[model samples]
Target: MQFELQKALPVLERTPQVVESLLYGLPDEWIHNNEGGDTWTPFEIVAHLIHGEKTDWIPRAQVILGEGNKEFVPFDMKGHIKEGKGKTLSQLLDEFKILRKENLAQLQALGPTEEMLDLTGIHPSLGTVTLRHLLASWVVHDLTHIHQLSRVMAKQYSEAVGPWKQFMGVLGGKR
Candidate 1:
């Protein structure tokens, strides 16, 4: 479908709640374990989403809108690691909701026209891209992380599921 802010806003607005609902009050094992290696836990994913709210979405949109920065800064996906170190999961979830609300309000305030949405901006790695792609990406990024969050959480039961693990696509190694 064509990128439409009105259509996208509902998902964008509810993403934080979806995340919070899934993870708000689980035990440490459920909230903190990862798929291992350098992968993020649900806790860390919340932090990363908060980081994106503060640094990635509206900031880059401002660049596209010609508010200040002319080119997108390379996003620090790992910045959440440090930013979230001392915070609890509840704090991170609260912060994510607030920041996302603010950013969405700012976006609406921009009142971008089709011409503005069609305007191009320079991404550090992806070269030139349009505002429409950026907005669509903001919605999809929430979805991608939501999917990642679910998959990572489900994989925590990879071994416990035993014989049924093969049927669980989320746990991978599907036979």
Candidate 2:
């Protein structure tokens, strides 16, 4: 599918509100609640989102637009551990909101054209990615993490949910 900034910009803009509505004012215990195994807590997920806002989407778009076929830097998925340390949930959310707004403005200012969407950049892993792919992935990435945060939070009540686990997909379903 073609990359549609008109569709994507709204989703990107609303991400902070969506996250805040889901997580704001929750107790530390609930925010820090994990699903066990290697899963992340809601706090960790927001932290990771903040990290992405700082480093991922706009930086990569710049590479695709400015340096066609040049190698792009790999994003550190686990960088949140050090980057997010000593930060409260509110700080992370506020930072993400500001960063996302700035990034979106930067993207719009670029005035992307149809040809620009076909521009290529070399991913450190996937290799030879298009601008369309990068932009689409950015939108999808936000949605993926939102769903992930919901699932992680829902699973905190796994035991309390009792027999409803079969009916409650978020508790046991694959993401």
Candidate 3:
């Protein structure tokens, strides 16, 4: 589907709630174990989302809006490891909710126009991008992590499911 800012806000707004539903207060099995080495657990993904909320989406939009730097600084993909240290899953969830809420409010307050949506910013690596793309990505990025949370959790049951594994596509092959 074509990206529409109006079409996207609902997903963006609900992402925190959705993520919180999945991870808040879950057991270590669901919150800590990942699909494998270096893959983020559900808990870390919350921190990653919090990191993106602070550094990625709205910051990049503001840059394109001519409010700040013309180019986005490279994001630290693993920044969540340190950022999440000493924080509980519940705290990360709460932080994500607040950060996302404030960022959305700021985006609306920026009052983007049709022309503004087409205005561009330089990504540190991907090069030129539009406000529209950034907004759409923000939506999909939320969905991606939600999917990751489900997939990682499902995989926790991969061995136990046995013959039923074929019915569970989220538990994709190869562990």
Write one digit per residue (lDDT tens) for candidate 2, span 24-115: 89999789988898888888898888888778888888988884447788889898786579999989888888888998999999988889
TM-score of each: 0.94, 0.94, 0.95
Model 2 global lDDT (CA atoms, 0 to 1):
0.86
Q: Once superposed on the true structure, which residue ranges of model 1 sit more than 4 Å away at CA?
A: 67-69, 173-175
Give the CA lDDT, 0 to 100, for residue 51 in model 1. Answer: 84
Clashes of each: 0, 0, 0
Predicted structure 3, TM vs. truth: 0.95
Q: Write the per-residue lDDT of candidate 3 for residues 1-175, one digit (tens) a residue.
A: 9887778889999999988877777888799899998798888898999999989998888889876568998999998988799989988988899999999999989988788999999998889989988888889899999999999898899899998887787886543
Better of 1 and 2 by lDDT: 1
Deviation (Å) of 131 in candidate 1: 0.9
TM-score-better candidate, 2 vs 3: 3
**Each candidate's root-mean-square deviation in Å?**
1.6, 1.9, 2.0
C-alpha RMSD (angstroms) for model 1: 1.6
Rank list by lDDT:
1, 3, 2
lDDT of each: 0.90, 0.86, 0.88
What's the CA RMSD of model 2 in angstroms? 1.9
